[model samples]
Structure formats: C-alpha cells, structure tokens
Target: MTLAASDRGVVEPSGLMAHYEPRRPVDLGATLGHHRRGAGDPCFAVEGGSFWLTLRTVAGTATLRLSPTPSGVRAEAWGDGAGEALHSVPELLGEGDDWSELDVSAHPLLSDSAHRNPGLRLSRTGRVLDALAPAVIEQRITSVEAFRAWRVLVARHGEEAPGPGPARLRVSPTAAAWKRIPSWEWHRAGVDPGRAATVIRAAGVAAGLERTAVASRGGTDVWRRLRSVVGVGEWTAAETAQRAHGDPDAVSFGDYHLASTVGWALCGEPVDDDALAELLEPWRGQRQRVVRLVLASGFRPPRRGPRMTIQDHRTY
Candidate 1:
C-alpha cells in the first residue's frame, strides 16, 4: 500500500519522502509512542492512524507525517531537517530490530503475549536529547504531572512546526533555548528545581550526549555516558535508552511502580526491584521487550492502594 499525498491532503512539493517495509507486521501508533506525551501532545499529534512528528535534528527542525502501510510505513517531511527525518524513518519504525534471540516459549505468559501482539516493535529515535529532556521531568513524579510540565515547557519555548501539518504541532526547544528557560517560568510550569536543573545541565552538554546515539560503543557504554550527568540515574538512563536506541535490556530499575507491576504480572504478587531483576535474568538482553509484551498482555496487577496523587508544584 503506497501513500500518496492526495490520500490525506495535498502533499507539499518541498517535502521529502521515504518508505519502509518491516520484516514483521508493524503497528505505527504503538511504535511511535516514544515521541508522544499524551492525547494532545504539542510535539506529536495523531490523526486517525497517521502520526505527525515535530522534531529537532542536526539539520534543523522538521515535521514528519507518517502513515502505516500494509507492508510497513511511509514518511513525509518538510523543513530544514526533512532529509534527516526521511533517513530516520526505518529506525523510527523499528524496521531493523532483530528479535531472533528472544525466545518467549520459556514462559507461558510471555509466549501468550508475544503471540497476541506479533507486530510489537521497539522504536529507536536515535536522539538522546529528545528523550532525556522529558525523562528528567518525569523523575519521581506522576505521569500526569510530568506530561503537564512537558506541555507547558514545550508550548512556551518550542518553535512552530514547519509545513502543512497540524497547527498544534511544535518542535521541542533547542538545547540553547532549553538552557535559556527562566527559573520563574520553570516554576510556573510546575517543574521542581531538581528536574529543571537536570534538564538545564543536560542542555549544556547536549552535543556530547547526542553522540551516544551513534556511538559504536554498546548499550552499556551508552548508559555509562548518560549516567555521567549528575541527576541522570538508573531509571532516567533506562527510560532514555529505551526510546533513543531501542535498548532491549534497559530495565527501568528505579521507576516508582515498574518492579511491582512486573512482579504482579509474572508472579501474581508485588515484588521489589531485586526480585524483578532476578526473575528477568533469563532474558537479560531482552528484558525491556519482555516487559513491553507483558504490558501489552492486558494483565494489570490488582489495584491495592490509592494511585499517586497529582501534585501541583505551581501552587507551591
């Protein structure tokens, strides 16, 4: 299935295009979750089954409109970074991900989930800064609060997405722009000093951090580089790696709820990070993949307590 400009609307002549056919079935929406914050994320928008991604690249900012094809996915982009965006379509869609080493047969639950969602793939954006900024905001906070802070920051500092994409689309702030964000504005956006300071520090060394994406070093090496930043720890590095490089083994060790969730899904009871690690040791190199499958399995742990309350830092 080819995607022509006329299928959605008139395609701009200045835009670049690319297509990818995955070896396995592909789910475009699920694959692109790394770039989206929530339903109305300013940086990414979903119209029906199609995705509009506003990203900042080495070349500049670009907005990509991607639609799933029966064979794979098609990408269209406009702006200074159009070529870079088009070139990244395959990586963004998980076309090159190799799963032959993953054997779900050892665990019945995993096997069932893998069978149920064969199209599941780990997308790699190959841009560490993009993932790191948001991960910092998410540190020790509820997802709703983190998302709200992200939306506020992006809306205030990000540039309008170029081309004929959705009006709501905007490119995330550049590293310099991020560094320039005033402390007062950070407060207004409900961002605490810790997360805000981490983001600022990351922006200061954005280039060095971005290099980890294309480094010949292994995932462990990349994690080490990410962790060199003071506030970036196990959970933050794992979350960044998961999206920036499709790091299969980057288990979010310090996430507030992941250990319990994984334990409940696999053992029908909550467990600590140590127990979860031991349980997932057999699939050491593919732990993230296993976790994703479990999440897709619709096996929610029984709710035993009140959910984390959304704190309004802005009020303070």
Candidate 2:
C-alpha cells in the first residue's frame, strides 16, 4: 500500500479504491454504523465526509474508508488485507439484504417507517469473533458500560490500523491477543469477571464460531454455535448474528428494553419477552426487521424507572 501525508500533517494511505452500487437504496452510515461499539469507538469513525473502519480480515488487519456517492458507495482500503476488505464492501453495505420478507402493511407505523427509510438495510460484517466479543462484553450490562469497556480495552490492546486514516483508529485484537488479556485489564476496563471469562472462552474457540457463521443457513447454526459459549445466551447470540450474518430474524429476546420498546410501540403498553414474542408472531421470519423498523420509527417507550447505573468493576 502507498502512503501519503496531508498538508495538515495527518498520514493517509492512497490505497486501492472500489465502488459498489446496491440494487436497492442503501444508507451507508446507518447500515455500517451498526458495527460501531459506541460513538467514540476506536475501530469506527466518521470524519471528513467518510466512514472509516478498522478490522482484522482473513488476510490481515485493514483500514477501510467509505464515502457516499450519487449512485452508490465508494471505498478505499489499506494494509495486507486491502483487497479482501474492498471485496467485502458490498456485503458490508447490505448488497445481499433482501427486504421483501418484511410485511410493513401489518401496522401503519411500520408502513410509515418503511416508506420513510427505504435506504435502511441490515449489514453483514462476516467476522463472527469480532461481532461476538463485543456482544459478550455487552451481556447483562448497560450499553454505556459495555461500550466503555470495549473502547478502553481495544484502545489499549489493539494494533493501530494500517492506513492514513484516523491516527487513533485500531483494529480489534486478534483471538490470541484477546485470550492473552489479563484479568486485571478486564477489571480496569470496568468489565466483570463473568463477562471477561465469557470473552476469553469465546476467543479460545474463535475459529469454530467463525466457521459456524459461514456454515449458517438462515442463522440457526450461528445462533446455536454462539450460545454454546458459557456466557453467551439468546440476546448475545441474536446481536452477533444480526451483524455477522445479517440474520433478519435475530430478535434480541432477552434485552432489558427491547420487549418494552416493542410493546409500547405495538401494544400501547409495556410487555415482557413472552408478550413481545406473541406480538411478533406474525413476522416470525423477519422479527428483527420489524424491530429495526420500530426503532427507526422514533417511538421510544417512556422512562418508567431510573436509568441503569454504571458499574465500575475496578473498585472490586
């Protein structure tokens, strides 16, 4: 890969460029931004009119920059895995996502959301371990806690991305690197022992998990494989499957807020997981799509209680 320095003193890579025009309308940011651990995620960024992502691909670590164009999305990749990164752009941008199964006409809110955001589509990252690690960290914790732990750990342990992209951007640690993270580091990052153990266990068997993602048909196998990890469960597996394989039916069944969110939006009251399941029965094959549409509809359930307090494991 070729490198160049901008007059502003930031190094940037002038690497291979590729463009993909999706058959359906695509919202570049909404589709890819789902992978971001948080707004301040070290591995994902939005700067200078482009989206930058750093990930470990089959070939190696790569930094990818995506910019929206009139017709589609344009991409530039750097590092040993540049070609593979560029090649994965279409899938990353939801080129294979088919929205035909979503029956929005079942509700006016769903119909309106579908009409308003025709460009919204589910993205497939195809890196199961990368997706699973964060999901494990997020298990049973508030998103604020989970995102913070992910950011702190990745920034400290991950390698700097190979590109003239953002200086602070880093790819997630490799499976071995993840396994090597000491227990103290997890505590320092505000991660509890259970979540930490789960992540390490998943890393130890990363290859099998990734294979399950590849071998998955409609996401069942991937769900089973992910849940096989001790700390992983229905919610965590669904979260991983949604990103790693673009499984449209991967509803987060055990999420603290999801059932209430769906219940309030669809039933005019809060509901538990059972009620949420019953309400979503009409869209069995595409429950996640319905969830996404509900989220995009901007109907957050009213705060019925105090927000979850952030837990700091370092004190323990």
Candidate 3:
C-alpha cells in the first residue's frame, strides 16, 4: 500500500503500529471533526495532512496519529495504551457504522447528498466522559465561548501526550482531573458555574457513564443514563451519544440551531424543535445521518437575527 513519505520515518514498537483498511472510502474530517473542541484544542490537531488525537484510556494515556493511504489508514500510537489505541482505530474511523437502515430516497436533497458523499459516516470514540465533558461545557453558550473554555481548561489541566505529535497537542484531562478543577479556574476559563458543575458531577460517575456505552441495553438506555446526570439534558446527552456510542439516531433535539437548519434544508422553511422532530420522523433510525447530509449539503436558512456574541461569565 502506498503511504505518505512521512509515514516511513516513524519507528515504533510492534504493538504501536497498525493499519485499518476500510471496505469503502471514509471521510476522516467529516466523520471525526466533531471531536475537536476547537481549532486550538490541545487534545486534537490536524497537522501535516494527518490527524492527531490524545486520550486517557482505561489502560493509560495514549497519543494516536492517523494518515490516509491508498489502501486504508495508517495509524501510529504511543504510551501505555498504544495497543489499545491502535485497536480502536477502526471504530474511531466509523468502521462499525451501519448505513443499511438509511433510506434517503424519500428526500431528493438527502438522496443527492448520500450519492455525493458516500464516504461520510458517524465516528464512535467509545469514551463517554470524554464526549460528555466537552458537550456540557458547550451548553447554552456560543461555540466560540465553549471552544475557548475547553481549550483553556484542557491546555491548563491536561497531561502531556505520549507520542511525538505536534507541539500543541496534549492528552485530555482524566475524570479525576476534571473533577478537581477549582471554581476559580473554571471562572478563569469562562465556563459558567452551571456548565462547570455539570462536568464535575458527571465526572464523579464517569465509570458508570462509560459503562453505558458498552452496555447492551441499547441507545435508549444510554441516553437515559446520560440524562440522569445533573444538568445533562437532551442536547448534551445527544451530543455525547453521537460520539461515545456512534449512535445513528441521537439527534440534537434541543440545539438552538439544528431544528432550523434541518428544517430549511429539508423543507425550505425554518422549524422549531417540535416541528423538526415530526419532520425527521420519516428517518427515525437514521436521523443523525440525515442531519449530517443536510449539513454537508451546504444549505442554510436566511439569517433572521444577529449572530450570538461571545460572552465572558467572569466579566459578568
């Protein structure tokens, strides 16, 4: 298999080197881009035309770098959990995502999008707290504010990554570390008390939450468990489920903009959350996939209000 010249220079242990050949082409960016908290996120990076990710795994910390090759994807990992990290490459790249249930023929736009971007698929990280914490930080805030808060808090508290990744990359903070973040630090990071408290509460029961991902009780149970956490609601749980379980149907129900965006793309009119639900019912089991198609279709509703401004809770 032909690989980038840069892949040749990496000398790693047998356990740290691995590759995944997807049956069909996969769009790494479209599938995994949501995991990036922001452009400056210390836990993720896209440099030298490759993707870098650092995670706190069950075994230990790991840094993984993925590069696409003609045959498939080449992955190299470092740290105690390198083997575990390498093993997760396929799932992380959407290898297990089943699109057989998706029938987009009912909607011409969705049909065209499905035909256009066959490589798009939802990714599963299989780490609950990792997904939930960032989602909580993002609640009720502009993306700019949430992303900035994540960047600051992670860069300040997260550990150094194990691999020879880009200088900016770091491992995401562990549950304990997240729980231990002081109030002043959260304030300094511009994460309001409500969001900060939610993250801390969830981190306290992170093991239980992570277990829900591997449980066979189904996505409904996973959603219920996630929502049980104080302050975690439909939006946060759906966002976490999308990444942690690669749940195909976990639509972001309460998102401020999702209903409107999906509405405009599907029916040429903006819709409220209730209307969006009814509109998307036709694709119940693959709603998130349809959402992805709508987003990728480049259709946007007319702006009816000013863009939400970035806010600093510290200043308030």
**Model 2: per-residue Cα lDDT over 29-96, one tens digit each:** 76886888888899999998899998788889999999988877778989998877876776777755
Q: What 10-residue stretch in candidate 2 is worst by lDDT?
A: 2-11
How well does each candidate superpose onto the true structure, as a TM-score?
A: 0.93, 0.93, 0.93
Global lDDT scores for all candidate models? 0.83, 0.83, 0.84
> Compared with the true structure, what per-residue lDDT tens digits does model 3 show for residues 34-142?
7888788888899987999998777899999998877778888899988778767777777667797788897899999999888897888889999999999999899
Candidate 1 weakest ten by summed lDDT: 3-12
lDDT for each residue of candidate 1 in 103-167, tens digit (9 for 90 to 100): 98978889998888887888888888889999999998898988888899999999999998778
**Once all C-alphas are superposed, what RMSD does model 3 give against the true structure?**
4.5
Q: In candidate 2, which residue pairs clash? A: 11-164, 12-164, 13-164
Give the number of colliding residue pairs in candidate 1.
Answer: 0
Per-residue lDDT of 170 in model 2: 92
Worst 10 residues of 3 by lDDT: 2-11
